[model samples]
Target chain A: MTLPKTRWRRRSAARPDEILDAALTAFIEAGFDAARMDDIAARAGISKAGVYLYFGSKEALLRALIDREIAPIATLLAGFAETGGADPEGTLHLMATVAIERLSDPRFFAVPRLIIAISGRFPDIADYYRTEIVERAIAALSSLIAKGVAQGVFRPVDPVLAVRAVVGPVLFAALWRHVLRGDTDVPPARVIEGQIDLLLNGLKP
Target chain B: MTLPKTRWRRRSAARPDEILDAALTAFIEAGFDAARMDDIAARAGISKAGVYLYFGSKEALLRALIDREIAPIATLLAGFAETGGADPEGTLHLMATVAIERLSDPRFFAVPRLIIAISGRFPDIADYYRTEIVERAIAALSSLIAKGVAQGVFRPVDPVLAVRAVVGPVLFAALWRHVLRGDTDVPPARVIEGQIDLLLNGLKP
Candidate 1:
């Protein structure tokens, strides 16, 4: 097959990131199944063979994308969980703030959207995402909440349920902003701060 | 075109509901753009013409399904908001319970899932859902929260963010149960109650 002219461009350290970026755009625009490697290569300014050299298959690219984009967040959450035991509330606020900032960006939010959209057709992708990104994040958050409970700063609530409370609004905000394309008059940071305040302080006068 | 053998069944008052049920299944199984009217009719035990007679197009069928399945819930929420001024906390509890109960069901949750999946490809569908279902629900819930604040039962939180707090966990639960297919160790009602308690009481000792 004839290679695109841009394929002659020299490879650099940023090749993987460029390819993944292109893959994300292709997947979002054309869907995972319909997105072709040729298009992804062209978008990345590489040859199809170069794309394949980096990612053996489309699924591998997705997995790498998840790792590249979401895994670091999960790792950061874990780091916070470990370091935040002495001050869970403050750590939780920091965590939520970071999460809201990241998710508010449509490019960062696209992975979960892609997973949610295609999960029914590809259970394995859903399973991978749940295990790799979602479950790890929940586990880290749960540990932080559990630390708060242990310290007697917070009430004894089930960590699982508490994690949901912590994550739900953040997730919803992302969905509202990205998926539904709702207009957000309030800045994302402000919205998240409000949510965190409500969680920590309750609605009682 | 030859009609499917099952098309001869007599039309009943339930025909519309049947067609909608079939349409939902078809749409979920095959992405909205890929789902065929012929398959929907066959699934509903009606002819293609019969399907078209009731619904002019696939988009129409989707709209009708949303009305049939989700509109009443919005109406119910509005009713609660109207009557809930006297007891905002109690009414909020009742509302969350109702939402959790309905969303826990996969069949009931499918519409939102479908919308989230296809909104990128079909902006009009997304807009229709936002205006018809999500916005209405948020408005009703926000009004209820405002009543709570007016009565001093709730702190003066911004009704918009407050609505997100109220909705986030419940929506997350549905996504957890249906999309990720997470195993629910705690029952949904209990989970919702825990979240509501966390919201109203805060996490403090």
Candidate 2:
């Protein structure tokens, strides 16, 4: 028996990435509850049925987007201590650098905005972010700071608070860029550099 | 013509403040678009006409809210130097404490969230904030930092960037509490203290 194969199968198979990209825009522009699947499909040049075929539902699509696009950069925190950088200051600086680079991408920044905008209506997004991104980053950064304090390379500071100190500024820069455009947000890279410079000094013994 | 004898006139004369208070709660709960004038009136225990008599329109109400509620704290930065703190570190610490104390009020924090959430759809709110609040705060904070640097109390860093370094984290903390409340945002007071502690060292000459 010969299957009646068409170009649609191959096209639909490749549609997830494009659909996800469109979904990001849709989610940002319209927000979560107001975002329509058809709009996303239309933006991606795919059919409604194809979107459903690939993502199954909106929740699945969001989860897929987070896992595929966001979780990797966020998970960079997990391997941070295992990575290169001999000095703790250098290591923390590296983390700031990586965060700035990763979050500079509008796509990455959009996810958090979507999470912030939607988390009110959808409580799980908060938990998802807290567990998936914030907790991991805090854990990794805290470990690095703890090492620095132990090695006498850095002054003693609450590792958790110190990590929040670092993350808060970086996250703020990203949030400004994500939420409002124009002259509102200072360049994220500049903020990152400034934050790391302050940290390098502030964490000194 | 004889004026109609009614208690409504007396009530409506007292309407603006109560209406503004109710407006804050309504705006926070339902957001700007979804929030209804009737709900605000009901919440204020005033007639709908009383709200209109006082504020005129929603835009006018918002402007009054900013002028009455947010603009005052923003203007507080203007007199910061004239205030009773002796040293620059103490001055900056004072500023941080004042910021934390003032912003910890849910009413104040809610204004920023409403502005951030609705600014995309309503550009005026952003401009209103930029002028009436943000620019004021920045200008004041910049002056404070510049004075510290000149007096040899703080290192010479770009006051603008330094002001940002101060504000970004504070704003982030406030935003977390405003946008996604749970265990996510560190209490504003703790962030303020930690930030000031770091600033004390980082800005030391």
Q: What are the per-candidate TM-scores when only chain A is compared? A: 0.89, 0.85
Candidate 2 chain A, poorest ten consecutive residues by summed lDDT: A175-184
Return the clash pairs for model 1, or none: none
lDDT to native, each model = 0.85, 0.71
lDDT of 1 by residue, A165-185 (tens): 889999998888777889988
Candidate 1 lDDT over residue span B28-68, tens digit each: 78766668899999999888999888888888887887888
Q: Residue-wise lDDT of candidate 2 within B133-162, one digit each (tens)? A: 877887787787777777777777767666
In candidate 2 the C-alpha lDDT for residue B159 amounts to 72
Name the candidate that leads on lDDT. Answer: 1
> In terms of TM-score, which candidate is strongest?
1
Which residue pairs does candidate 2 place in steric collision? none
Best by DockQ: 1
Q: Looking at the true structure's interface, with contacts defined as alpha carbon pairs within 8 Å between chains A and B, what fraction does model 1 recover?
A: 0.72
lDDT of 2 at B106: 74
Specify the CAPRI tier of model 1: medium
